[model samples]
Target chain A: MSTIPHDAPAVIDARGLNKVFRDFWGRPKVRAVQDLTLEVRSGEVFGLLGPNGSGKSTTIKMLLGLLYPTSGELRVLGGSPRDAATRERLGYMPEESYLYKYLTAQETLEFYASLGGLRSRRRRQRVDEMIELVGLASARHRRVGEFSKGMARRVGFAQALIHDPDVLLLDEPTSGLDPIGCRQVKDLILDLARRGKTILVCSHYLADMQDVCDRVAILLDGRVCAQGPVRELVRQPDTWRITLEGVDDALRDRLVAYLQEQCGRPVAVEPAGRSLESLFVDVVTRQRAASPPP
Target chain B: MNLPRLVAIVRLTLRDAVRSRVVVSLLAALLLVLVGLPLLVQSDGTPAGRLRIILEYALAAAIGLLSAATLWAGCATVAAELQDRRLFIVLAKPVHRWEIWLGKWLGIVVMDAAALAVTGLVVAALVAVIRPAGGADSQFEALLSARDTFHPDWAAAGLVRAVPAAAGDTRQFEPKSVALLPGHSLDFTFPVSATAPGGPMELRARLGSARPNRAPFASLWEFGPPGKPVSVVTSTNAPGLSMALAVPAAAWSPGGVHVRLTNPVGRDPATLVLGTGVGGVELLVPRDGFAVNLTRGLLVVFARLAFLAALGVTAGCLLSLPVAVFVSIFVLVLIASAGYVQTVAVTGMYYIPLESEAPELGWLDRVVLGVFRIMNVATAPLIRLEPVALLADGRRVAWAIVAEAGLLLGLAYSAVASLFGLWFFTRREVGRAGTE
Candidate 1:
């Protein structure tokens, strides 16, 4: 609930970022990322929200230095993402689940751990811890190829955390997950943030981001349309709703005018109030609260 | 340099590759052929010959299949992972792109090399076991002592009787009058000859011993006008004639006469006389003159496999899996068929023997030949450097193997680069919620 310090240096920093893709004939085909700038400070969960083809993944790729930006100054952990030292402190989970089908959950973590420069003993230990952390300890010996979508996602999460990275860049971490899996991922993100890890999450699930992320950036047409603290941006100003039974048009108009005069803002009348999702949440909450303890 | 890290990466790559059913199946198939072929070819001939045949066929099959598998495996190992976005997790780590590429290539090379070594050893052992029992000396002697005699259609006439001894003499005999076919020639210059007052004798002679003796000889009579009457005479110690004489016009016959012989030192000498009817003259010829060059065959196979594999890997890197495989296999077949096509076309040219004279096809033929010539020039370098050419000789096979390994590594690196480039371009952020 506490606010992140504004003075803290951003773990990820980008300025005037641009990525242009050219066809085989050397002509520009798509301006995947335009001049864009953004920052994410330490110990904060910054979400990059966008629809498909909105350059969210492109921006993330550039930030990770998997791709060289057409023109941009981007840094991770105060160093170039392409730099080994910088990369060692960073973790990434792509939008697609890409675990080696032949590798078991433990092996996947171990392989990644080795790449991150962990010694054998340390790698084994870290892999174990990661498997437990991602709640994949029971299935650590199972090949990733045999895993379901949700299980593969868990393995991916385990690999990302295997190195104990300072910065975590996850692309659709909760995608193709069951409700329980989604909740677990959300909790994991929150837990990592609590551990003072800087997390950059790109996902289409706005509601999930609203619940877990401290701040969110909405990208549109290769540019950020809106970005700020989720709570602050979503807060409605002087907005009120009332439900009336069998209300006539004249009474509604009169009541609207009176409310506007009193509040100095428009008052809307509706036939109902609660959103279906909110009702569902309330029902689930009540059921959980009423259930007997195990 | 992080040796442990590199080793770990290589181990991981190999482990991952082994788990791929495609790789496992291909390797299994190769092993099956390698083991099965020798057993099947065990009965063909001596262990060496059978081994040679089996090894030749097995190596050919292995090279083709393994090359294809290695190329496909190399591309699929990295490219598929990237396509499926699985590589992001590994790339996300602290590993360098080059290291990833190197590790994958090492894994492929290790697996392929292991397979090749096993197959090669099996072939060598089989060949050793099946080789012919005789040593080189015996084989060589057998080759050299083969007869130089020739078969004749007509049966020789009359009995060849050994004459009995006459006082202090060994033996003597005479040949009866023999008719000759027109336009035919005969040479007769014995070690000792004398006319016996039958008919005007036709003497024809030349220089050289009758047998293949190392000594030289001189002619007794000069070749002269046909049908001239001259009594034939030769020294008792004169050498055998080396020349043939034609019976230009007349067919003179002598009633059976004795050909007397005596030693130059006044000792008795053995003599034999033979009779013959009309006959045609012909020279005896040897038939077994050609030898097989095994090295050439081996070299051709090696070069073909290496070239095909290289192109396959290149194509795989440049195109998608299915298209690359198809195109590479097609090119391999095309190249192999090219030799035969060239032979046929050249034979056709010889058959006609005058392309320029055929007005209707002159330009077309010229253009075709020109294209073929250009192709020959372009392919000459490839042919010279082909794996087989490099490895044809026993001494060079080692170097050829090394070069082939280098080529495979190069192709693998190129494929990784291409896949990485593609992955880099297509990757993008879909939403903010998934970021760390």
Candidate 2:
């Protein structure tokens, strides 16, 4: 979990959380969240990983009080989600990047800042800071309606951080972003975590989760299937590999036989090296390094 | 709880609306309908007449159009923002749900009011410019024309002559003598001479009516002024006809001769004065007329607009945009048609067959009719109270506006609640990354 000390109070705590939705015909349609038990400690980047329709969005919605759970004990900043006072300590960036299309990037930030009860002077400062922080300063005057999806997502991130809340819940923060934009968002999440903000990030990009998250909870069919530190979850045991060049056929056969005798199972030999895809990625990375920055 | 914050939210909402092209387009359309239509249809006539017609049409159109626009704008205020999830960002903050609701509601109300005022002023200005310049002069000319045809002509003249015939003759006069006598005239004396000789012969006298076929005739003396009275003789041969050989002294006058028709029958006869000095003649006939005073029409239009504004606001609160507009317009149409329907029904022009007596309408229709009684009600008082009604009417319009404000505030509260809920709900750990 990124070496976070366990003694800190969990920024988010929930027990026995459940949410049920009914269809238009008044029949129970789906259980979007079920018996979810989780804790997000302070100063950690937590990722929620799931496939489509896996209750990732639903759990996020319930956390934000956009939808009520069927039954649960949940707390953010040690208070009810529906409570206004509790909301002051939280910020959320929805999965869809919902924003007023008529407002410019700056206006959007200012509006959210106002809602956060920030005073005018401080709101202006915070707006500028956020715009620059999200790398939207150059396009701050452009209406959100004219912005690209990635740019709009950046504005969404800016609004979520306008109030500088204690916790940030971002749903699919980098869903539609290009590589550079995704990296920027990942870097922002890391920066926010480093500044002692607790963040719950929901994304489908497992590589992104592996790169940035201190821990992750994988959801399937409205329930978390597994959750822990990414490295620990994917850790392997008793697996060894050796690479050698110019080995004779007799030496290869002897090595294989020796290993097979040493272990109770069949010892197999294959190419011992980095994956081709990884090598290719490294080659592209080096090629890009050869070029000047745009 | 935070009034300033709420105000800020409201300000932002109004700003957003002002910047929205949809609202701008709708407002522009409303303004065009209010101002342009009246000017286009305005008749080239006296200011009062033009005003009367334009005010009537413009007021109706403005009230309908503006109310609809405003109500529609109101319906979209919350539902659209929520649908787009833009509300989610705002609600995620520390704002209250009620504040959001109130802010959105206020934004819509302000927009509607702006539209209403612009349209109302346009109609009012049209009315002001069209009001008749002089009220009494117009009324006097109308009355004079109404009284002209009823006055009768009082000057007319006719001559009378008498002829004498011989006694024992069956004919009152020979055909040759009848030709020498004057045409029909009022007979003041009876003729006694007929054959150039005085004799006490009874005269068979006939009075001709105005026409020749069936005329009333009177025997008269041939001597003296055409219309002067003379003695009449009963004999047919007398040169100067005399009645009892005496003539009344007062019958003759210097200026003109007097003529009178004495009815032999005892029944009273009707007479029309035919002399220049005729007096005390009166003519009466039934007449039909219609008039529209522009000032009164203006007052009525204003009253209707006020009523409609209230109704539109109320409808906005109760239903979504499309439904609210439909229902409100239907109500307006029904109300406008009530008078025409009632008039046709009262006059037996309605042809519905009745199997049984129709049930009387209850209090709801009564109240609607009472409030919108366009024809018979005292419209001035209502017009005078337009300002007060807008502010104080307890009906849905006023209450809807109030409730809308409340709803906006409620939205703000819900927004904040939603944010908190999202944060709380998402923070939980389902279990490991894939195997709960």
Candidate 3:
């Protein structure tokens, strides 16, 4: 029931969203967001891509009601973003791990759970589950200030999901994360999307976005330059890539020559190796697996 | 609006105060001040004086330290969180902004109450342990008990008119302020409401001489109604010396009592002037126990600190950490100096010594005084509610005063500050860091 048809009504709908930073005299300073019209279907993984100061964070802030747009219409969960009731179903994780440093991981999640109106027993249960889910079980009792950047980000992520919200707005979710943390976060996003949670992620990690995001909108200087399904946008009709197994150097050379003869151009040949992130993750995982934490 | 969210914020605030070592440091500082202060300040060497020193000076210093710590904690709780970006998480939650302000204020108040209770207990225990042996129980009771002051009903006695002292000295004095000539007596009648407990009362008088010479003068004080003097005292006093007389309950009537002070014909022909204002002519009657008096004093002090906590939080909500602290401290200094402001407002002059050279119109002084007048109107109640002077002098801190303080300073002032803070904090742009 969480997933809707391709033409289903939009859970997040914004049209002509514009946010302009102003000076003391009300003169327009920086147009942080401009003519932003976007939509994400129910239970979809949407990515917002931009370089620094390209309105990605600004857009996320607007959706979360942290910042008001200069001129636009933004609705989250079928109501204005400023509505407190609407926020009950929305969760936001900011760019930085904005958590109380003095609170332990469990306490941090518990606090957010309470804010989300979770009852006492359920709050405690969810806090425990979140700690486990974030892989912070060992450091659950440690103060967040003492955690490393990746661990803090995990706690931040846990707090955002503590309420079991319908929609998640994450800004630079994997900025401080290591490769393993980033991989875990990506998997978690995919899992949440599978469980029918609408997730809008803003990040510069193009590969991670490509891996988990169903659709993406690339922003350049406060404007959307391209937006479509990840597969649809990245596909090329003129290029073809083929992978083969058990082929020697002579066979590989023959295949490339045949392709070039057919296409009337030189065919580029390169071995497909594992990504560095995958290699690092594999090495760390195998080492940790060989010597499991006690 | 969300009670659970409010509780969560309060709990987190208290936890931060504890984990940051602010509470521990505050307690340590208070203990050092309370226990070590008696050693530093010189007492009168008598047991009564030593006890007074502990109760008056040490307790005052402890309360001051507690107040400062409360303000610091209040500022750090809100402003530091905003600067550190922790508040962004809270704001992003479904909690209302007012809940956050109230929670932080409650946390500071609860912590303040704990500190105050502990300090009170320690002081009381110290008093119990170090009490001087063999001191008269009556003396101790008189020193420690809260006593109400009864002033003579000058208007009821038709003595409201001011009598001229001498020719060309246009300064008129109250009829009760008369200087008695030899063999001439001045009678003062005071109405006693039935509420006043009938018992032994203490009468203190400051005798002033018309002559500059200091010499012993004989005078007689008669108590009770006409021709039915229950108590009569004939005493000699050096010029300008203060004296105390004890009158038994038999001298008092349910309706009223008349006391006649007569300068009996003596070797010194100089007249004597009874003091002026409440201090000039009054009766002391004991009321509440020392414990209740101390509690009332602490309550008023707590109310003041609660107001400060709200103010600190309000400032912190708008300003960064250092700037918030500075503004809070500045406001504290202004409130504390209300006495000077009051003087300026009343006299329309900042310096009393420059009165002769002061401009007749004094436009600049008038402007400053006008501003201070408004400030004094706002701040006088808080300054006057300080119980230190009353407690030191063994006078009762009236419950009415305590109630007024709670209503005006605790509830009203804090509510206004909290509203302002919530308004500013909610509308503020938290996405930008380190903003004013």
- Report the candidate with higher DockQ, 1 versus 2: 1
lDDT of candidate 2 over A1-294, digit per residue (tens): 356787878988988899877654868877878999889999988889989988888787667766767898888888877678888989999888888888899988988888888888999999999998988878999999999999999998888889889899998898778677787788888888888999999998888888889989998988989988877887777876678898888999998999888897787787557655457666766887999447
State the lDDT of candidate 3 residue by residue for A186-259, as single tens digits. Answer: 98998998888999999998988999888899999899999988888999977878888999999998898898
Best by DockQ: 3
Candidate 2, superposed: residue stretches over 4 Å from native? A240-294, B39-44, B124-436
Per-residue alpha-carbon lDDT of model 2 for B329-432, expressed as tens digits? 67555654555555543443333436476546578656555545443232233232232222111111223333333343234323443344334323322211
Residue-level lDDT of model 1, residues B91-155, one tens digit each, is: 77787765665566566666665655555565545444544455343222222121121111222
Give the poorly placed runs of model 3, Cα more than 4 Å off: A1-6, A23-28, B134-140, B161-176, B195-200, B214-216, B223-242, B247-251, B256-258, B353-358, B433-436
On a 0 to 1 TM-score scale, where does candidate 3 land against the true structure?
A: 0.93
* Model 3: TM-score, first chain: 0.97
> Model 3 over residues B276-363: C-alpha lDDT tens digits?
5767777777777778888898888889889989998888888889999998887778877889988887777777666567666567
For candidate 3 chain A, which ten residues in a row score worst on lDDT? A1-10
Q: Tell me how each candidate scores on DockQ against the true complex.
A: 0.34, 0.28, 0.76
Across all models, the iRMS values in order are: 4.0, 5.9, 1.1
Clash count, one per candidate: 38, 78, 0
Full ranking by DockQ = 3, 1, 2
Alpha-carbon error at A275 in model 1, in Å?
A: 11
